[model samples]
Target: MTLPSLLKRALADLWNDLGTHMLTTVVIFLSALIFSFFSLIYFNLQNFVEHFGTELGLVIYLNKATPQDRIPALYQKLAGLEGVQAVVYISPDAAFKRLASYLKDEKDVLKGVDPKFLPPSFELRINRAVFHLDRLKRLAEKINRWPEVTKVQYGQEWLNKLKRFSVLLRAVVLISGLLLVLSSAFVVSNTIKLTVYAREQEMEILRLVGATNGFIQGPFLIEAFFQGLLGSGLALAFLYAGYRYVETLMGASCLLKGVNISFLPWTFIGIILFGSIFLCVSGTALAMRRFLRL
Candidate 1:
């Protein structure tokens, strides 16, 4: 049969069982929405991690006994280190000023504080190409052993926590996404099976009249395709609406003050839509295989 004829048959069959088809679509819609929600969270979190990585650097404090003349040499040595993009020396006075700036209105707390007590430090910006926790730790350890260095800090605890969180989130998204996909396919398969069973006698009649399996399966597959398209489309729309609402609400609060949480990109959106359609089609094919014994 022609494409148009197949589509017409599919639409008629769906119309005949409108309630069941709508319910099936709704189920698929919910599944897709949840899966997309997880994906969006994962995407934003990964982006944040990468952004943090780009800004990741080490701060090495110099001992008070370290001579001011030795600072230039120390800076040169640090700049030569692997993964060191740049090295900037912050003198005690500059460090004190930075502290005061951070304190803003609370600067009164530093009225009795002396800049001489503040240690001079080297700020080392790391190269993104060589950025890694292990490498950073090694660099820090090596720097800390220097006679002029008092301490080396790169927010190790915070970085470690962020890394662990990213890994855990990824695992959760993957495991949950897999479970959701399987469950969705199972639901779609069962729903299609019901439709197939209802038309078993008709399909048998067509088969006896020498109809090819492809010809018999075309309409059901098309029906499944429509179900997937509609369900996924609606899911995305709803997800986007929810995303905007949350974004707007968060914008007015300090919760995500400096953070920008974005919606799923176009590429991810396309993938979800395609995956949903493929999932439904595969489910329908499975149903056809079992019921029609093809």
Candidate 2:
């Protein structure tokens, strides 16, 4: 069939079967939307986990009488170490300043506590990529041996748990999303098959009349594809609306006092659209295969 003729037939088919096609498309679209939203969330959570892990390390607290002049030398000693990337010194005065600044919002409480009571410390950030754990531990031990070194804080037990959980969470999210997408495709496929069955006699007659394979099934395939596209588009619209609504309602909630997460980036948005297209295509192909045989 000519392109124009095929397109005309396709449009007519879609119009005639609008009700059923619409339902199939809507189902697939909804599936894609739910999958995209949770996948976005999973990626964001993985980012959070990595950032948290990167910040994990030792906090070396210095002794009360550690002289100001020796602070730089101590810092240099640690900085020059094989595993140490950089050393940030927090003097007693600086520590007090940070504490006071944090408590500044509570004026009454800020006035009561002496900031001088806070200890001087070094915020040690190591190059874990190059730093051997045993060597780093030894350096910490050497630093702690000094009379002017009060304590050494190293190794968080939660590191393993956090990493493991992040992996598990991503796996769960992906698997669940995939299974749901398949279920949606199945629903859509069955819907399209029923729509095709409604006009099975007409299809057989076209076959008997020597209609080309493309000529006979092209309209049905086109109709199925249109449904999938329309459904996915609606689902995307709904997801965006719901995301915006939730952000507005809970933007200032107390539960997220420390979290500063945002919605998925534009790349993810593109991925969602592409993923929707793929699901729609797959469902259409499956439904059309069965219908074509019948």
Models 1 onward score TM values of 0.87, 0.70
Among all candidates shown, the one with the greatest lDDT: 1
Measured with C-alpha atoms, the lDDT of residue 202 in candidate 2 is 84
Clashes of 2: 0
Model 2 clashing residue pairs (backbone): none
In the order shown, the candidates' Cα RMSDs to the true structure are 2.6, 5.3
Q: After superposition, how far is residue 182 of candidate 1 from its true place, in Å?
A: 2.5
Per-residue error for 203 in candidate 2, Å, reads 2.2
lDDT of 2 by residue, 1-294 (tens): 887788798898878777876777768777877776777677767666555544656689988777889898988877887767778988777887787787777646656677678889998887756544455557778888978788987664565566577678788878978898779867876786787678878878887888767877777666665666676667667877877777766677788645555677778767666666666666666655754663
Candidate no. 2 TM-score: 0.70
- CA shift of 239, model 1, Å: 1.5
Task: Compute the lDDT for candidate 2.
Answer: 0.72
